[model samples]
Target: MAKIKDHPLRYDLVNELHARPFPALTVPCHAVYVAIKEAEHAVNRDRAADRAHLLALLDRNGSPHPQPDATHFSGAMGRHHLKWESHTEFVTYSAFGSGVSSRAFDPMEADVFPQDWLAGAPGTRLTSVLIRVEELPQDEAEMLAKLDDWFVPESLAMARVVDGAAVIAGDFRIDPAGHMRFAVFVKKGTGERRVGRIVQRLCEVETYRAMSMLGLMRARGLSGKLNTLDPQLSQLISGMNSPDHSPEEVLQTLLKISAELESLAVQFSFRFGATEAYEAIVTQRVSVMREVRVEGRQTFGEFMMRRYDPAMRTVKSVDARLRGMAERATRAAELLRTRVDVERSAQNQKLLESMDARADLQLRLQTTVEGLSVVAISYYAANLLAYIAYPVTEGLGLSKGMSMAIMVPVVILGVWAMVRRIRHKFH
Candidate 1:
């Protein structure tokens, strides 16, 4: 029997599925998460720099290094467990500690990464969050009081998820310390892995929400630009249908608008695309929570729908308008080109007709000149015949004037016939 060879990537690909497993978080643990991204070209940022930054953080705590070229790492950083993962457009650092902070939703708990280490990060912080995990209180009334005290009542979103295995709540507001906060209350019998997954999803929701809003901000910034470009495009397109404007002039204007629009599209392409992708991730993560109503409070999905969705829609609308404007500009240019081509074709036709008329006049003038030449030749031939026949006329008893008179008509007729034959043969 022949043995089969395995693909080089088979094992690596298989292991990839298990690569970024959720942390097995115990109850009463606290997590601090931060996502960092470049101001521009984040997806193409230097990976080596990110790795070096991660190494710097690990070195601060005297922890072991990740494998060479690792995309993710899980290790102990002092008393806290640190998890770092690299993504397409950003990187995230999360530190999970064994016990909750003494103060509920305390922003100081996020100090797992030393201030100096954070200051040395390669990119800007997109979002930072502090998550508090605790065992679910048996008294529902006490939990409600804690929630009301910890979070703003107006913006709070709370729900029970995973078939009531845990309850989650967040105000989705940045506190004075500049971090979003979330609290997870797990049931007594909940698995540690399930708790970890819930915390992970919460972090992901916040991260993706922040990322998606970047697109909204970009769209809002482009509003004034679009307002100006739209009218200019409309005016240029309208000029196409007006006889007052020349096609060449209109075409120039349209081309300028098209170039400008193309440049704008190129600038925003990545941002818009990344936003849409992040938005999808956000929605998916929320849906996976399988949220049930928190009665008198908004659910996570409902909050996003009410606030976030509208902004995303505006971005999408602006993107469509930009595309539409570009298309309109293209159509206007094509229309102008067609008009120019038609005008040129008409001019060429008139030129050909004028040439044909000139050719006809020249032909008629040449015919007139040929007629005069024949008469002149005939007159000379008659005179020559008269001279040559003078002696013969005297011998034949005929007068010279009479002989010449007889030859004149015959010479004229002969010259006319000869000229006609030449013209016919050439033709």
Candidate 2:
């Protein structure tokens, strides 16, 4: 066992590599040491012959020899103590029971390939490599040159060493006991930008995928309602669902469908709201009209009492004037009939009185004429008698004149009495 010193720069040297896990070649240090020891032993046994043969093979093949395929490498290392595995075509070489390994040399395809000869041994400590590099002599220039080539500085800021038979990134070195080890260091900022680019690409792809899904879902919903559509509208909707359409185009069609739906919703809402408002107004107006009708009836009754009654009095006055004119016309007609009747009655009474007066005057005139006629007849008869007497009396003695006087009075009396008797008979 080697006594190891604590190295402060060891943490910085391996920080980057330890930050992330990487697929690389790994081999146990014990297995690598054993393989080197076996090669040295083989060289000592037939040094002259083996050296000549190695030189000839190198001359013939070239500087770096090509590794065999995976199957060939696996078969060759199957009997070794170390077990080798490939990750993403990179080989991981380690001892079967060792907790340590060394990664060196990339394969042709950039894979990590494990050496077949190193197997079945324990791993060396990371401190062993630094101790071995410190033990190398710096006496001769050629020896110093060899050491310089075998061990490399870890980085600009860290002091570290790399020493092994295969100096992957440093100078070769050996300890007092002839054991070997290799450096394990990390590189910072390696492949970080590449990873970031890959992550961004993934995000963009996922976003577009989500948008496409949403458009398809909306298109499906629209298609379900197509049957109730108008003929002209259905034709337009059918065109949007065509098999050749892209998701973006389908989304545009869905936007147009939403526009039409919004317009219909607005129109229906306006009509319903307006109709409700109108009905309410009409109901209010009817109530107002009913109130007005009641008021009008009451007002008309009051008008009949205040204004119409006075107007009716004026009408009665005009009626009285008309009645007076009708009565005057009736009275005039009656007066004319009465005047005609009175004139006729008076004329009839006058005619009857004149006839009576004329008859009475005729009767009085007839009586006077009869009295004169009797006086004349009696006077003649008396004269004749007197003449006879005178003749005889002259012989005896009487006068004819005195006898005429006496007969006149008696004749008047007899005419008057005869006239009175005739008048009585007529009565």
In order of listing, the candidates' clash counts read 0, 16
Query: Model 2: per-residue lDDT, tens digit, 1-427?
Result: 9989869888757863543332222222112312111221021223333233223333332433223322111212222232222222112233211123232221111111122212322221111121111122224344335434544422101111111111112222343433333322212222433322222222222222222222233334433443243343444445543568643454454445545554443433332333234334433322222221111122212322353334333333333333433343334334434544675788888988998898789867876776666667556755665665667655645455665566557756765677678779977
Top lDDT hit: 1
- Candidate 2 error regions (>4 Å): 1-293, 297-327, 342-364, 376-408, 424-427
Predictions in order: lDDT: 0.90, 0.34
For model 1, what is the error of residue 177's alpha carbon versus the real structure, in angstroms, after optimal superposition? Answer: 1.2
lDDT of 1 by residue, 1-427 (tens): 9989999999999999998999999999999999999866556666899999999888888999999889999989999999999988889999999898778978778788778888888889999999999999998777888899999999899999999999999999999999999989899989999999999999999999999999998998888899999988887776677889778888887898899999999988888988899899999999999999866678999999998999999989989998888888888788788989999999999999999999999989989998999899999999998899899888988898889888999999999999999999988
For model 1, the superposed segments whose C-alpha errors exceed 4 Å read: 373-427
**Every model: Cα RMSD to truth:** 3.0, 59.2
